[model samples]
Target: MNAYDLVRGLHILAVIAWMAGMLFLPRLYAYDAEQNAKPEPLKSEMQALLRTWQTRLLRIILNPAMILALIFGVWLFWLRSGQGADWSFAHQPWMITKLIGVVLLFGWHGFLAGQRKKIAAGTSKYSGRFWRMTNEIPFVLAIIMVLSVTTEWTLR
Candidate 1:
């Protein structure tokens, strides 16, 4: 009904899009790796297609969505704190948990980057182990976030 509600709705959607795309991207990288590891080499057309699609996906879609989601999250939190609760960094369990998940999520990105690097260098091979490991990163964070949400303010 109000502007805040509209912004919050869009913000949630943006966060979902960003997180889902980010989670799926590693798998996409694995797919690209398959193509990249062909016997000869990727043809110029194939390379061009990869470059174009990857660039558009990240630059035009993922990055903007992530930035907007982050901004909107900050705004929503500020609104929440403004209403009553005090949100601080020093000693909130949920905050700390979320922060940890964020760090792990960043580390997950490092793994993704490593896979991409190895793929680019023509040294990467995808195995079940690799995919499982890469996929677990986000799942772990999702679990943490879910738990944090459910018990964040209660068990103190």
Candidate 2:
């Protein structure tokens, strides 16, 4: 239909891809951690495989999806602001709240990238349980962001 609709659709798809990658990556980390406690050729082989999986997912899908999602998300935010003529909508507390969640989500992504590096290098500092816990971050942020965008809490 419209350009906004198209951009929004693409943004949603990118988010799906990005979230899927985020969900799966930490499992890879957990698996890597498990493999690390093993011995010899199996350990090395599993580590190499997990490293390859993590790197490819990060560089090939996750990073690009994140960039696209950000671009489209920003575009949608700007679109909602209605050019430069209107500023009232942008001042909504819900908008600010949503943005904070987004910022935190991005920070989580950065943290994952660092973790990826450590896991790949076999120098990860945390346990598999740590990664398992961190995997819930996106879900929490998603809930907050969805509520912020969908409900008129500020308008009430």
Candidate 3:
């Protein structure tokens, strides 16, 4: 309807896209790690295919989606501020919480990228179990963020 509404929609869409890759990539890593125990050409073939998928997911989906989400999210925040929404941490603890969650998500994205590089380089020390456990990070963060926004959770 309005510009704020449009930006908010874009932000949500981008976040969904980002989350898809965030959730799926770790599973791919888990499979790749597990493949190390398999024999010969099968292991090599699976790793190569997984690596390709990882690279494309990161480059084509994750990176652009994250950047767009950040941009649109900031736009929404600016629009809200223009409409006199309180953004200060003291006045809007939920906003601060959401922002912190976003930062953590970004950090997780970076960590995954680093892990992908290590995996490609044949130097990753992480196990399939580790990757599987860590795959829940984004989902947990999303719950906190969504609740913060929907509840307007605050100290006051």
Alpha-carbon TM-score of each model against the true structure: 0.69, 0.94, 0.94
Candidate 2 on 43-152: residue-level lDDT in tens? 99988988999999999988998999999998887776675567676778878888898899799889989988877666779888888888888888888888887884
1 or 3, greater by TM-score: 3
lDDT, candidate 1, 54-123, per-residue tens: 5556666666776787788677666657544676532577867866776676566556556555655657
The TM-score that candidate 3 achieves is: 0.94
Measured by TM-score, the strongest candidate is: 3
Clashing residue pairs for model 1: none
Best by lDDT: 3
Point out the worst 10-residue segment of candidate 1 by lDDT. Answer: 36-45
Ranking by lDDT: 3, 2, 1
Residue 99 lDDT in candidate 3:
86
Deviating ranges (above 4 Å) for candidate 3:
83-91
Q: How accurate is candidate 3 locally (lDDT)?
A: 0.93
Over 1-156, each residue of candidate 3 has an lDDT whose tens digit, in order, gives: 899989999999999999999999999999999999999899999999999999999999999999999999888888887755665643588988898999999999999999999999999999999999999999999999989988987775
